[model samples]
Target: TLSEIATMAGVTPSTVSRALNPAASHLLSKKTSERILALCDHVGYRPSLLARGTATGFTYKVAMILHDMEKDLNAHDWNRITCATSAFLQESGYSLVLLRTSEKGTSMDMQVSHFLMSGIADAYITSPSMLKNNTLEMLNSLKSPLFVICEHGVPFPVSDGVLRSDADAFKQVWSRIPKEMHGKICFLSTINDNTQRLLTNIKRAAWDLGIDANNAISTLSLARTSKVPAMEYAEAYHQTKKMIKSFNQFDFVWCISDFFALGVKDALTECGRCPGKDVFILGYGDLETFPGVSEKPVLSTISANTHEIARNMCSVIMKKLDGEHTDIVTVKSSFISRSTF
Candidate 1:
């Protein structure tokens, strides 16, 4: 790491970023940089914003807006949003300013205006914040260039939606699963306006697959804790664990996320049912970065491509920002097929 950092810093494999990094901004003070950097070997330190900017002419700072900081501390859907945004922003030469209620002088939503107003960031992109939050509601009222990154659905004045690539696989999982596998299939998803968009896409895909999503029972699985429950592998497992144990007439289990799918897996295990084998289990948000139901013999899942989502969302925003759109451009989820069916 020191060697890598030194190479990046360019002084020597021994010169550390702390020595050269500007303390006023976000790193060590000049004196400290000189003290330790001179003595220490560059063991793989990363370039600080100020130093990198001087050379590249780019600070790469991105102002990422999210309502809850706790969500990142304890990952859930919010984590997915964070990862995707960071990956895309960095690839395009930007850093992130995680806007929360406290960071902004007054409110969370105001953080965007505050940062943009101050000219701290080159552009403002909307991070996945909950729809129910008061700050988020206020944000919705303002027409910010905020693009929806991994949003559950499109928000108002915020069209150009970006999300993971694996969105389309929901239907395939349902089709492979027998309608009779469970007495009634239960779909556990986050409760928000985004639900409609997700359901809309799923419904359309399901119809194409000859599956009627409207007929399916909807069981809500809001986040009780952002942390994925250990009882089952995913949130879907815990959300409907009781139902599964009661031998609830549900035939199949569907979840909006792999976190939930893991939950379903555990529930099935408890009920003596086989996931992907005897019973059908499905998950959205195919996380190649993180392991999910794909490894399970009976589980099927769709992986979301953050890269594609970001690219598409950015394209839509550039056009809209340029006054090129009369309405919003919707980005749907992609599909990843595993043996879970």
Candidate 2:
């Protein structure tokens, strides 16, 4: 099969081998490696990782520990990160193995221990939440090359990390609103430690911007019992309707996520309130516009730069695997102003 691939690529079998090898791939010309990789992909030829590991003592597999794989797989940021990480890893002749630590009855310690002992993967990439548990301890004790993606909060000192400026991004979004609307702002977010921190930061920003932080800013936290993504939309819609009934003074709604903002917009329209004109709404996570959904209101939100995050995350992991020290990387967020807010 290697010979066949080499023949197709007009290279020798040894050259094909080098192109497919993560460590040795750097020896080959970029053009040659890309051509050989294209042929391999076109032919659907996957090198046996087990065999290669046995021969070279490297699995060429990278384990990705997700917070909650099922729920996060549907979420916009997680989906984009997964795609970008997979693409970058593939280019480096590595494959990704996903593991969920939040699943019921799933022991993260045992899973990580098994991988370490069995040589299932050479390096690991995980969410910051894993640092709160014994997962980080186990990985550190084993001296594994670990890279963390700081999506929620500050991560434990691992090898390196990719951090997001969530609070700063929120402040940026808040600052863009008209000063008059700042006094009538309502924030909708999930009840979590990280969100509580974000809420505090938002309040601080409000005070700094001369908005009445105590009386003007209002907040509602949704219970985190459901993993169903659509439940977020439903809960947001229901709460917006209830907020309208109880306090119809607020003129702006800032949701923690774009999905929730969509629900808030729907509720406003149903209640005979114009989203942009009567009550502007803002959301985080600049999710892609859905296909065949042109009539949906355009949401002004912060783009977390999921693609760049994933790229840098993988880059840091690769550097660690190559015995290079890397520092924590912070990716800035940008505001995407749309029709809604």
Candidate 3:
């Protein structure tokens, strides 16, 4: 059937073969490859994995380790980063081994060591739940090749490069808020470098604008555990809710995460205060679909643009593997202004 079709198209079986496989498609002209694929679809042609594998020395597999799939998927920047990284990895001729490192029994450190010990994957790209757990410190000490997705100490030992969130420079953006809004502004985030960086940056901005940073209090949520401790989120909700009560004048509430802020929003509603109307809410990591969630005080946020983050991490891996050394790169953040002013 292949030869018959190739003859009718005035092309050799080898041309058809090249068109059938993506790795070989470069040998065929773009139009020829397109026509071949179109005709192959008509004939239901598929490439044989066995032959392809023998030709290429690589199984083209990569292992990705993250803390929480829910948060990882729901998180705005990191989610986009992982998805984009996966796409790039696939197109670059590699498969993904997605590993949820911080499950109930498994420690993130152990997960990294185990994967490294297995030696099954070509390389590793890890987004250690730096905020959720204290794993980033430990993950840094490992001997394997790794890429970090968060900010920590100066440099990582095992990590040839780091891809950090641009939230560190967020203070620059927050500083631009009106001088009157400085004391009225509240910074939010879980206890992480990026969160602290956000606070530090804003506080500096606040100071420059003659605003008191103390007017804003930072509240940390559940540790980066496999599953957020049942009470951690609840306690944070209550604590923030309670803190909100102490404020006689709070104009803006900055939350590190949108999903987490949703919890805070719930607490505010319990107090009979309408969000966005009575209080403004700003969130980082524009993640979560807010499924079955109604519009209560529009939540404004900045997206982490993880697509670039992921791509950068992958590029770092490729460069390092090629004996190139580069400094860690930070991914840019995006802002969304909702009615939560």
TM-score of each model, paired residue for residue: 0.61, 0.80, 0.68
- The alpha-carbon deviation from the true structure for residue 141 of candidate 3, after best TM-score superposition, in angstroms, is 13
Error of 2 at 126 (Å): 1.7
Candidate 3 per-residue lDDT, tens place, 26-87, comes to 98889998998888888776655555556654445677766666766654455566778888
Per-residue lDDT over 164-274 for candidate 2, one digit per residue giving the tens place of the 0 to 100 score: 766666667667777776557878787772576667767776677676777767886666656555577887787778776643677888888887888888988999988
**Which regions of candidate 1 fall more than 4 Å away from where they truly are?**
1-60, 76-81, 102-113, 130-145, 150-153, 159-167, 178-183, 189-201, 208-212, 216-242, 245-248, 287-298, 311-331
Ranking of all candidate structures by their lDDT, best first: 2, 3, 1
lDDT of 1 by residue, 147-201 (tens): 5554444345444555442335665555665555423766666554246666676
RMSD of each: 9.0, 4.0, 5.5
Score candidate 1 by lDDT: 0.54
Q: Name the lDDT of candidate 3.
A: 0.62
Report every candidate's CA lDDT.
0.54, 0.75, 0.62
Q: Model 2: clashing residue pairs? A: none
lDDT of the structure predicted as candidate 2: 0.75
